[model samples]
Target: MSAEQLPALVVVAPLVAAPVALLARRALPAWMVATAACGFSFVAALALAVQVTSGGAVSYALGSWPPPWGIEYRVDVLSAFVLVLVSGVATVVAPFAWASASAELERERLYLFYALYCLCVAGLLGMTATGDAFNLFVFMEIASLSSYVLIALGRDRRALLSAYQYLVLGTIGATFYVIGIGLLYLMTGTLNMADMAARLSDISSTRPVLAALAFITVGVSLKLALFPLHLWLPNAYTYAPSAVTAFLAATGTKVSVYVLLRFYFGVFGTRIVLEELPMSQILLALSVVAIVTASLVALWQADLKRLLAYSSIAQIGYITLGISMASREGLTAAVVHLFNHGITKGALFLLVGGVALRAGHAGFDRLQGLARTMPLTSLGIVIAGLSLIGTPGTAGFVSKWYLVLGAIEAGRWWLAAFIVATSLIAVAYIWRFVEAAYLAPLGGATPRAGEAPAAMLVPAWILVAASVWFGFDTSYSVQGAARAAALLLQ
Candidate 1:
């Protein structure tokens, strides 16, 4: 299909497959349906990315209706890049789900789980693609609802509590988002982002506009789990099924970050957020706190899954730090880290999934001497871990390098130093796993810790391979992010 058709297809494709997955019940036939849906979404995202790169920004009026009057699905390089990240991660995570699900989920619920997964993907895609502010909330609810269910479906009883926590926080986030959208509509009498942007320019300094900004920022920060607002994340990741962990870890908060970008840069305009107000300072300070605090917490985690979960908060801090820089370089770093960290976290979580398959849990004590039995999986974890630490020649380095460059450009030497300092903290937490897996004995408890089934390993390795590949061959992702940043700044 043409690029213009791609947006509708992106949303509809998954929605259609979701029901088919539900109907495919018991036969395990839903796997194919889910795979096909994700595959189509992936291709659509790539097509959109290609079109955005080669043809520039494209917008589709829903039902041929113009914006501010009707909904618009905007596909700039920025949103397209995020679409690619989200859909691509969903597609990759599905295969891992096949094997991981059988062990962690009830047989009958597999189809239901996958159906919800597609719904979550659709919701996220809708959130990113739609140019309508109200429509964004609609999609946000769709994604949040499905995510709550997916998280709760974990085998452990704690999964229920984790999901409930996420639900409460997510609901609050969505409600705040709606309140903000309502405030914007009240001020501008329009639901479209671009239209609102143009109208909001006049009253950018008004109390209502400032209030809306505060509401939206807090709402998105909660969704993104920025710093102290991140209470729901550790439990959500640690107790959820491994495949769910991989998918949510890779795309969930990243999507929230994209929402922040859309509102801060696309709707409110950078002049108001960065200059008219003090967004940069607030974001920068919070981001630094998240990096240091989250890492400190991660260093003390005994469960490998929880450790990576805390690390995600720190990683998000890097992305937010980039946004706070508010320079082209900083935005570029934020965008690039969004992708790089997605793959890094996905690989790490998927590796944890593999360990779960073997020993039925991912506690650090259980993973001792796993290197001897699960050589390939452990090696993949090592590579991903190295990337997470921003080691040279890894995907993580590119973003951190750009981040440091952005700080230098902004003349914030201490910020750059803080970036490096946090990387050491990353190394410290990652090293805990490295030591437990490679150096310590298997401790008689993990005799069955041979290796995960091939299904799990394949998907895990794909992410690991991409982490290494992107680390070395940065021309594509970097260029995409740089161009996307320029458009966002414009």
Candidate 2:
């Protein structure tokens, strides 16, 4: 692939593959096309990341037109890092879906599943890669709409209601975001993010600009499921097909978080968002509540997926809490945790998919003595669970350590204490699973299905192994996040 064409190809490959997969009209062929498309995006993203690392930033104008007149695709340190994250997770999750989807979806709709899968990946990558603010909203909708349908494809009928709830909330979020973009365009007269940033400086303190910030913050917060706006997450995760849940859990909200970061520091600049206004304090307050409340809620969930879904909220809180600090250390923790949590949660959900495939559900009863049959999957979950709890020598601990360092550097010792204290709540929830799978007797709650096919287990373990590897080697994730954070501060 040409260096000049890599950015477009990264998004277009999956966009084109979606149609091809849909026309295939069969599960296997469609999945092959979708997986190949994700593979292409992954490779392209890695190449872009390497280029960005060696050089400064990569910028490509669409249709041979220059920026401020035509749409641009830009990869900077932050966006390039996120591009690698979304594409890599898509590559891993696509392979796992073949076995998981076959067990959970109706045969007739499997082709459609792959189609939406490609569309979702394309949308997420577009959101990260684009240089235009309005274009990011368009991609956000593309990802959200496809995700709604994908979540509805579960064999369980409740998937319909979950999708509907998400549809309603998602529509509202889209409306708010687009409205904010409109306000910014009216004030700045440019949709290009870089141009807008330059233009917004003169009018940064104007009422409309402040309003735009508020609109975008609330809108993106809803999209990312921060705190009370997260009402739709538990049910959606609980009922969605396992593969879809894994994909979205790893990529979707993280992309929204990226957009929020882009707007806060990249477009508006920290002087306005963090110091001039109360945005940082607001984010900090909400993040603390999200982490504490969500962890407690997760502790009581009977449905395994819902429990992990709540755990996702807690993790997102950690990421956002880091962002609220706006220090170099804080932003580094925020960006790196995006990758760490994405892989850790993705691995957990994938291993849980094995349980869902064998037991036909992930309820507490179905998980009893799961280790007796699905030993590999069970053990994988425990490893990932330790990561989730920020145990030493795991990816989660790396993120938590940075967060505590950031807090202490900012002189928020109470925040540091809270960070450590809340982790105990996570330990409680993770131990519930350990008690069920390892200590509980093998009962009738579990099915006779021996284990998930290798097609599923192997992909899940890849992410599990990645969590351990990254914990020891901080060269890629930590360094990338640090550069991204430094770039934003610049």
Candidate 3:
């Protein structure tokens, strides 16, 4: 296929594979199909990004129809960058999911697991690849419904409650979002995002448009689990299947964040969103609170998954905080952290899943002197944890440095100080794991758990190593973020 077909193929591969995986009715074959589809999409996304970077935005009109009248799939620099992140995560997580699901799920249900995984991946990729407002909402539901079922498939009973909570709140968020889209369609008479942007430019200050903005903000906020609306996240992350937990934790909220960014900067002009409205200030306030409270709460959690879940909330705060800055540096920080944090959290959860696999649980009690037994998994967790804590020479530090620079650029020195202070809270929580695994002594009679199988460990370590590799080489994460920021701000 030519480069122009990449956008369609990026979302279609996994989407089409879902039914094929389901019909296979076997675990290994289903997993192979799922993994292959994800791999194909990731390659397509990379090619799409390269094409966009070298040439310009690529637009694929459905059925050869063009513009506001027909559905359009557009790939610009920002969307291309995000497509790479989302599909890339799905690609890496696919093999990890295969190993993880085989361990945690029943033999009969394996096909179902792979099918839902493909659907979820397709939904997220579509969310980034689509250029129409209503189309994004549709893809959002596809992803959300698949994820809710995926979370419910967990080995833990609490997974049901977690999935239910996410479903109810997720439904509310979707309703609000579609309503906002309805308003946009009502006002603009166009569903295509580029057309909407062009049409809304003149009447952006009107009440309907402003209300649409408000609705979109609250809706996207809930989807992204921004602060107070984040009740569903911790439990969902805590109880889901290990692979589901890692995949959702890595990509779910990040895609929501991309949607939020797309709506705020891409659809609504920055002037109206930032100047006429108080979203920047509101986002700033909520982000700071999320960082502080989630970090402190994380410090007290006994379950490794729960601790990382809260850390995700705090990490998301940093992302939104960067978005709230409304400057080039701030936007770059937000975008970079979005990618970096996704990798860091993905590695952490995958390793914790390994702990749960061998130890029967991932609670603090289960992990005492874990380093003595599950050496590779323990070390991987600690390294990723350091990235979480923004230690020097790690991807987390790259994000932190930009966050501080953004704060300084905005002349919010106190906010800069607050960012660092909150990172210390991260250090404290990450230390909880360190103390449990490395520093604590194990009872003499305790059985050795050995290490996770190489399949799981290798996938987890790839992300762990990336968290460090990105720290040293700013070429991809930082430069991609810079270009995306320029595109958004343009």
Best by lDDT: 2
Candidate 1 TM-score versus the reference: 0.99
lDDT of 1: 0.90
Model 2 per-residue lDDT tens digits across residues 1-490 = 6997888899999999999999999999999999999999999999999999999888999998899889999999899999999999999999999998988888898999999999999999999999999889889999999999999987889999999999999999989999999999999999999999999989899999999999999899999999979999988988999999998999899999999999999999998998899999999999999999999999999988999999999999999999999999999999999999999999999999988888888999988898898889899999999999999989999999999999999999999999999999999999999999899999788866887899999999999999988889989999999999999999
Per-residue lDDT for 59 in model 1? 90
Q: After the best TM-score superposition of candidate 1, give how far the Cα of residue 139 lies from its true spot, in angstroms.
A: 0.8
**Pairs of colliding residues, candidate 2:** none
User: What TM-score fits each model?
Assistant: 0.99, 0.99, 0.99
lDDT of 1 by residue, 20-46 (tens): 888888527788888888999999999
Residue 323, candidate 3: alpha-carbon lDDT: 98
Rate residue 105 of model 1 by lDDT: 83
- Residue-pair clash count for candidate 1: 0
Better of 1 and 3 by lDDT: 3
Off by over 4 Å in 3: 443-447
Better of 1 and 2 by TM-score: 2
lDDT of 3 by residue, 413-457 (tens): 999999999999999998888898889998343238588888888
